[model samples]
Target: MTTQFPTPANELDRILTLSDFNVDYSNFDDQFKDLAKLAASVAGTEISLVGLIDSYTQWIISGHGMEIQQTPREETVCQYTIMEEDHLEIENLSMDSRFQEKPFVTKDPNLRYYYGIPLKSEGHNIGTLCLLDRSAKKLAPEKTELLKIIAEEIVNRLKTYKTIELLRHKVTEVTDTKNKVVHDIRGPLGGIIGLAQIISEQGKDNNMDEVLEFINLIHKSGNSILELADEILSAEKKTTVKVKGDELNLRVFREKLEKLYVPQAKIKGIKFTVSISPETETVPFPKNKLLQITGNLISNAIKFTPQGGNVQVNLVLTARENPNVLRISVTDSGSGLTQSQIDNIIEGTSTSTEGTDGEAGYGFGLALVKHLIDGLRGSFNITSDQAGATFEVILPQ
Candidate 1:
């Protein structure tokens, strides 16, 4: 059967002009070139092109068996092939009505067999997947399907590249905003801290009650601002370390924990205890992340436990599925958290209730701890009862 293919009127005006089609390009990546070559080999064709029709020219992003790097859109047979709803294949262009009189086929390369598939994105035709051969040949039905799949893959890659470009632009905007806020905060914070120090010194000499009160208020306000700044900085920083199941010293880790929690434990009248199994010397973790996870747990334990209540921390190396894993538990004697609180710990919202001693926080500490544990590729769980709550963190060793 023979048929004549007519160009769509709407697209005729969108076609590129000859002057705008420039092909003298030199920079092209080897990987794309190799992909085009692979496609040519699979189709048993001498020439292949991963062609993209931009606003001006039908640019060959990657190509094989072509002397010129690019060509004018008006001269690009692939441009017309993209308009076809299905693969445009011909065993002989000389006999095809669409190309028998075309200048390129009659005068230039004297092309014969040609097959082109539309490279489509989101139902819009973008370009063509084309293969060329000197002699007439017909492709199997399966090969035609495979060519369509390859064209779709190319469109997927282009979409991914555009998404990454958008994310980079967003990250740059966020960084610039954070820098400006930090700069504005530093000067006023310094003055507040300095004034508080002066008031504290004056109160110490005169023993004036009003001066002492003012100094305490100023100190508390400054500390609150500093904590806010630290949280902002910590939240902005991306995770740098990858989780690996490396051994960490549990005994030494508990010692460092004691140093961090002792003062808070004293203030709350809580007795802190750390117990580790004799054989449990090391457990798998990134040391800094372990510290962050444990620190948040211990701080929460100290905060919730009432004065004279006991908080016990335990570490054990146990066999799970015949492989060693490390388990750490923090048990506190305080008003136990409700089931809802436990469920909401990983939620981004604040779930903090006032401690027995009224410790104030935005309830972000546990949320941050959960984020760190997740980054370490470990699991954490919580249980509550009348005696209090217990938190267990387990990591593969």
Candidate 2:
């Protein structure tokens, strides 16, 4: 590569990492295309590009009169341009020691004149907004300042894009959590009501043992429903329903979830399974929040899932990152959600939809669950396809 110039050892790696968070100008809107065109015209050059220099290649995100999308990092003037503290304006590439023999200057368009300004974001130079031409040229001192301003504008947009993405992720987490929590209450409440009626009507004829059994069932159902409520409510609102104090363990947590949803799944004719990793250590989590998240997830998975379909709960320790990760995932075989449904839910514009068994929901359970998770300093993710949906919660411990 013609005795590679004085490039920083780790600079390209850093640029590649930063590139992931920003927009690719290739698919960028017309405004950016217009910027590239303006840069070319103002510089009196034949070509211009908003280029992102990655670890291996130089990617052209947007430009005017730039036919190729990318080039070898060793071949472009923008590579050195990004390293400069300010604009890098070479009046004649063939006369420059570093770029004289570079293919970009000696072949094809044989580019000679180059004017570039590093695109900085979050204090790091990620790439360059550059003007190029085949003929010898010089950017006036006035034009150099203008190019720098345009480069700064591009950095501002990149930062804005990063902000929007984070917000969108948060919205989706809350929306899905809301959907699950809202759908949970109906099953336990319905069981309690139906059991109460059975006990009332058969009091005179049923044996004492049968009567006692029905009472026990009713009591269990009542407690389960109350726990669900306590979990769904906020920490302040939680006190209004009930008080819970216990650092939760993985084994007991999985058992509680199974106890709450196994019967409900059976009633709906769905196969339910729970798997707690044997390797999981005894880690402490707020029990109330734990129950609330899992209970809501299990109930919704069962509700929307078709009869004879399957729902599985998995609790595993993910040691891939710091603080170690506790991952709780629930998978359900149900009609998948559309992009519009997801967007509406996260955007707070969605109305509740009916479940497979004609079950109606208030539609904010998933949102509350999301809030609870956030309060716990955790992250939530979901993926749904034609077959069904899987919701994953990753918490640092």
Candidate 3:
């Protein structure tokens, strides 16, 4: 029996005029290859392919038992398969007018039976996972389900690739903004510092109260500008970890946090203390990330704690059947967070509240802290009671 598949002239025209879609498939690592092999194994097919369709060709990103890397779009049976909104299985393409004359059917791979599952992302159909056999055959229901599972995996991988690309663009933008800020501030800051030095020298023999005030103003302005530059620099650096479960010395980390926040705490008339169980000191973590996490917590604790209040940090290590873990907590004696604030922290939103001294924040620090913790595959939580709020981080060793 001969079947005539509907070929819409307008659709053909659009496809013909469309420019070639260029994607950097080389960036996809061994996962694609593994998926292709697994798909073929699960389907019990001789050939399996993870292919991407451009305007004029279908490029095979990864294939099992297939030497042909690409074929003309007009000749790829998978092209016809993707046109439909469902997974397709054709018992014999040679009996179908739409694919019988295609080069892939008569030439290289000598395809006969074809089953394709569309790979889609963000509502756009990008490619397909297909199994091909040299002879006409039908896939069992279980095999068909397995093929669809593999297709979903391919779609997930594409989504991940797109996410990484977006993050790279954002990182570049942040770095550019940081450089511009530094470049613009350096000139004015140097001038102020130089003029202040000159004024101090010239007023050496006079009562010089006005001169001294002017010099102090300039000095303070320079210091503020320097601090702003440092924050921008820190923000521009990529906070990614290549290795997980690397041990960090919690003892030294807590000491550094104490020293950094003590002066600020004292200024607010707040008492700061650190308490840890013996085993917590050698908690495994990516280096420097502990600093980022602890810095945000300690800074927030000091910023929000009221006068004559106290802020205490505690660390405890525990061993479980799954893995060893460390739990770090920062407790503050402040007005305490609202339920909404706790929800926002857990939900990863930009919810900011004024500090005791009306200090303002850009709502970026906690978001950055959350992002860093997620990167380390850790968990964070915020809890509050009558006394205050406690921020906790649980990290796998």
Candidate 4:
């Protein structure tokens, strides 16, 4: 009897989530290569792999102790693993009823062991991180938990990658829009200038009828310019406000920030934590704008902070105010910035500086954050001392 394979009930949604990462299978990333190595070490296995399962194939994005790149989804043992909630551990693949007839298990290398944890994104399992060996073995419970943490890290890195790509795309869109505006305006502007010169010459020659005709031509040209401006600028404004005006949930937003920064802080040997007051569970605010504001602030703190330092973020609601206020503060145990540096950042003129570990920075984020806050009619403040620094923002709720 042929063994039946299991598929997630939300398989379509799973595939869509995978697509959002815009993963490039042709040139695989080395970041996952390191994760595969760490997985192999932690599992004490001879081979480990990070595989992504699409609709029809299993893409082995990164592998340690092996050169295999991909396999047919119908024949992959990982297809079953992706359907698992936590993990699948087979002490002997050759003895398992489901996989015993598989060619890889019965032929050639005759693999005997398989252990896999599903790679979940957006609550759907899209792939697996697995260990393969020639001998049957069991993993310790503690190690199993550690492997789970590594799986979470893989998903977090994927999310961060997607966000960076999106930001770059937005920057390109803004530049293109600016260029279009300048290019389109030049023609109408030139016509108005020419008509004005004609009107001046006619006036100097004391020809009132001709001068009035030229003036009328200039008025028509000016109206055309106004129409072009309204058409382009209005469309842009509509789209921007639509995206930026959507309401944000404080709880969900906080979770995203933790996922984005906790791993970064860990790599830098810094402690990171976020706190949201009970009263601030939900707020009618723009998530993307909040992300930009806090992302820059938190990133700045972590970059400047030395190893073993602490970075804390807090979001609280002020009930005493007539319109409740949302207060955000990012505090860090980093090298304090000078007054001149602070002034430059507020003015959006600050240059990049090397971090505690010599990491390069452009120092543009804080300036962008300042601009965003000003547009919201919010307040941004910076306080620093020899011990550490704090950046605070207050927005009306």
Summarize candidate 1's per-residue lDDT along 184-243 as a digit string, tens digits: 796788788888888887776887888789778988898788778777766654321222
Candidates' C-alpha lDDT: 0.67, 0.69, 0.69, 0.77
Clashes of each: 0, 10, 1, 0
TM-score of each: 0.44, 0.49, 0.48, 0.50
lDDT of 4 by residue, 228-287 (tens): 777776666555323222235567667867865676688789999998887647543444
Rank list by lDDT: 4, 2, 3, 1
Q: On residues 1-397, what C-alpha lDDT tens digit does candidate 3 reach at each position?
A: 2223322233322322211121343334365889998988988889988887643246677888785555534456776766767788999988988788877788867889899987765444567899998899988998888788788888777666556646655665675676887978878888887877777777667678887887878888887887787777665443321222222456655665665556657767899998877754544443335655665687778768888999998877675536767778999998888898888877777545556775443344566567667866999989898799999998875
lDDT of model 4 at position 94: 85
Q: Please provide, for model 2 over 153-267, each residue's C-alpha lDDT reduced to its tens digit, 9 standing for 90 to 100.
A: 8777767766765675566457447656655776767678667767756766766777767776786777677666666654434332332223356776677666556766887
After superposition on all C-alphas, the RMSD of every candidate to the true structure, in Å, is 27.7, 21.8, 24.5, 17.8
Ranking by TM-score: 4, 2, 3, 1
At residue 332, candidate 1 shows an lDDT of: 98
Indicate which candidate wins on TM-score: 4
Residue 185 miss distance in model 1 (angstroms): 2.9
For model 3, the stretches where C-alpha displacement exceeds 4 angstroms are 1-22, 207-397
Q: How does candidate 3 score on lDDT?
A: 0.69
Candidate 2 positional error at 261, Å: 47
